[model samples]
Target: MADDRRKNRIFRGSLGLLLLSLVLSGGCWDRRELETLAVVTGMGLNYAAQGDGYEVAFQIVRAAQLQSASGGAGGGGELKPVWILRSTGPTVFEAVRNATFQSSRRLFLSHNQVLIISEAVAKGGLLPALEFFVRDHEPRNTQWLLLTPDEPVEILDAAAGLERVSALAIVDLMKQYQLTSKIKPVYLADYIKTRIEKTTANTLPIIRIYETAGKKELLLDGTAILKEDRLVGFLDHKETRGLLWVLGEVRGGVITVDLPGGGKATFEIFDAIPKVKVEFKEGRVQVKIEIKERAGLGAQTTYADLSTPEQFKKLENLQTKAIEDEIRAALAKAKAYKADIFGFGEYLYKHDHRTWQRLQKEWERYFVDAQVEIKIEAMVEELGLVTRPATYRELRK
Candidate 1:
């Protein structure tokens, strides 16, 4: 009987301990409730009006409103699915912490998708304003980075349209670069890596606010050129495409060329391959770029039929000249700014470190005067559905 009672007591104590361990293990130690978080989806940075500090905008997602929108109620009564909070301080970190004074929930930034910097901030020097995002563990390196000539806050306020959150819409807009290949999307990691390099410059796409029927929308305006960390200049849409072509980032776009007779012909680029060769002659750096593209006939505004081999070769020549002109335009803009957005300096460092070392101190001067040759070979493989114009007399007959 004594042995039986002792065994029962031991079993009871073991059972209790096991149950307690399970309960403790099941509870989350670092859990934060969803209601206590103001999740930041996008951030905008600008120089403060006083010109002594920073103005920051945080686009926070409203969980309740998001849920309501997805349920087909359109946010359950007039409250948008996002909340914009603006704050100012001497530094970005302080500005972020200051947001808690007006916000009910703690700010959470791990979900951030994009960062927009104003021209003032970028021109003044981006490194000072960008330190926080780089050091903070909350923001990811994959976040899309953009520049705006107007107020950065305006970009965050644009309508989402297809997306429930405006920030997500901005992300989707960056993804569309593959469609037109007119602008290259610079992510946070790409900028950081380029900025930290010894001789490489960086570039960011420009975002502008467009108003249609009183509704403001986001539009990609041009390319922002950054020599080191400061904004030096900008490239227009045509120039941006030229830069993209050299970077091998052009996926698809229409290249229009003037026809021999009259009017214009547009070629839909199906494939583009860019090759760059750097050579040194008598200590002079020379960059030779060859761009080969395959395109299909998109449209011919001219009445002349271009189905014959002779006519096709003429059309190809025109397209080649047009491509070379775009490349030259980009090169001229970069030279005017004295910015090596083409990574020529980095190329030299990798291929010939000794030469790069000699020119590293005055790379801008060399880059401005660097000898560049652009060669283009555009082949129109397919002529679309019909070889002749739809309005041609033979087709009509």
Candidate 2:
């Protein structure tokens, strides 16, 4: 009887200990509540005029305001779905922490979608301004990075028609790069990786504020070419497309060319592929780039029937010329700026490392003088609804 009672007591004690362990593990002690966090959607960096420091802007989403806006109440009149918090400090990390002083909740950066840097800050060197983001565990490396000539903070405040949060609206705009393939949509990871390369340079899309009908709007314009971490120059939309072709990043876009006689014709690009070859001969480097593109007829202002073999051939030739022109224009602009936005040097470094070492120091000099051969082959596969322009039958003589 005594042995039986001792065994039963031991089993009960073990059961009680197990129950206490389960109770203790029920809740997460380190978990943070959502209400205590001010979720940041975008960030902007600018050179502060007050002192030698950075002025940081945090675009924090207002959940209550966003909910109200989604419900069609317009945030009960005058309330914005996002709050822009500003702070300044000697370093980017300090500036980020300083944002807490203006808000009751802690600023959480895990959901940040965009980082806009002012031209002034970019010209100096972006690595310093971006160091904190890379070192911290919060901000994601995949967020879109933009360079703005206007105040960086202005990009966060720009009015968006569809998206209640301007930061998200900007992200949507960047994603449209696939539709046009003109603006280069560079993420933080891509930008930093290229910037760190020995010869590869960095290029970021430019954002500016446009005032239309007394309301400010965000406009994505041009490309900011960076030599290492400093802003060297910019490439317009056309030149930017040319760079895209060289980089083989062109996905889809429309190319317009002059008709045989008059008017214009637009071709919708379906596929664009570029092949590059680098050759080192007699102490000089030469690059050959060939682009093969397939497009369909999208629109034409001319009544010329492109259904005929001769007319279609002419159309294909015109498209080829136009593609070549775009590539040439980008090359000319890059040479003028002394910027290797094409990464020809990077190619050589990857394939022919020994040769790259000899020219790495003076790569920019050799790049401007490097011989480039461009060849384009464009094919128009599908015509639009009709064999020619929409009004071809009505306007036929």
Tens digits of lDDT, candidate 2, 88-110: 99999999899888999989999
Q: What's the TM-score of each model vs. the native?
A: 0.91, 0.93
Residue-level lDDT tens digits of model 1 in 150-266: 888888988866787878998998997877788889998899889988877789999888898888888888899998799989999889988988989899989899987679999
How many steric clashes does model 1 contain?
Answer: 0
- Kindly report which residue pairs in candidate 2 clash with one another: none
Candidate 2: where are CA atoms >4 Å away?
A: 1-30, 74-78, 390-397
lDDT of 1: 0.88
Global fold similarity of model 2 (TM-score)? 0.93
Instruction: Give the per-residue Cα lDDT of candidate 2 at 379.
Output: 88
